[model samples]
Target: MPFAHAVMHEENGVFGISFPDFPGCTTGADSEEEAIRKADEVLTFHVAGMLEDGEVLPVRRSLKELLSDPEAKEGLAKGVLFLARYELPRKSVRINISMDETLIEAIDRAAEHANQSRSGFLADAARQRIRDLLKAE
Candidate 1:
């Protein structure tokens, strides 16, 4: 995966990280390095979840491009701004799940066979688990 652009700054005595491509995704830490680490984790999870469910990742704008946008400026002024490459596939759904690792592994393998990433496979597994639970209840 490519390194997503991370905007780092200090706020309220802590470091803040934001991705311009993904709105509503932000994190803070006590230091710049920590902030970047948190940003990397957050981006990975966000991208993985999005890919699992097949959701479109919004294209991110470069810092220079963002600075030219009035809306972007307003967001930055409000202490929120960031961007990343479209990291995952796009889809939409809602589900509940409670499954063990064995089941999860099975789904993962199936997804791999289908050429889908683990996230995508686990998403389907979650859906199935939910359906089974509902049927049982």
Candidate 2:
């Protein structure tokens, strides 16, 4: 999970949002609630673009550290603080794996029934197993 501190405020009746750690990343809405929701969508897209560009995502900073920045200090002076959390997945990669022929055939049949490729089916299964194991821990 990665998070960015956000500041929400209104000027001329339009709500504005800002992410201190992400200087140029900003968005707004007509209401505070919509502003918060839009922030999540915007941040997710921003982070995805950063990833595509081979740039590291901005690290979250403490409120104190954020305030130390002149722009953040000025931008958030009259704003309410909130956090935007994101769980982003990396780009998929193909990998070689060994499985029993019988199991592979079964998997292929299951994948066809589910209307998914064998690789896609296996990836979905692996992801679900990971989630289940983590929950059991």
Give the 10-residue window scoring lowest on summed lDDT in candidate 1.
81-90
- lDDT tens string, model 1, 39-128? 766676667666556788666567788788786665577664443333343465656777798987887779889998776666666656
Cα error, residue 15 of model 1, in Å, equals 1.2
Candidate 2 lDDT by residue in tens digits, 1-137: 77899999899999888888877777888878778877876776667657745998877888898889888888778898899876686778888889999999999999999999998788778756754543333
Where model 2 places Cα greater than 4 Å from the true spot, the runs are 90-137
- Highest-scoring model, lDDT: 2
Clashes of 1: 10
Which number leads on TM-score? 2
TM values, all candidates: 0.52, 0.63
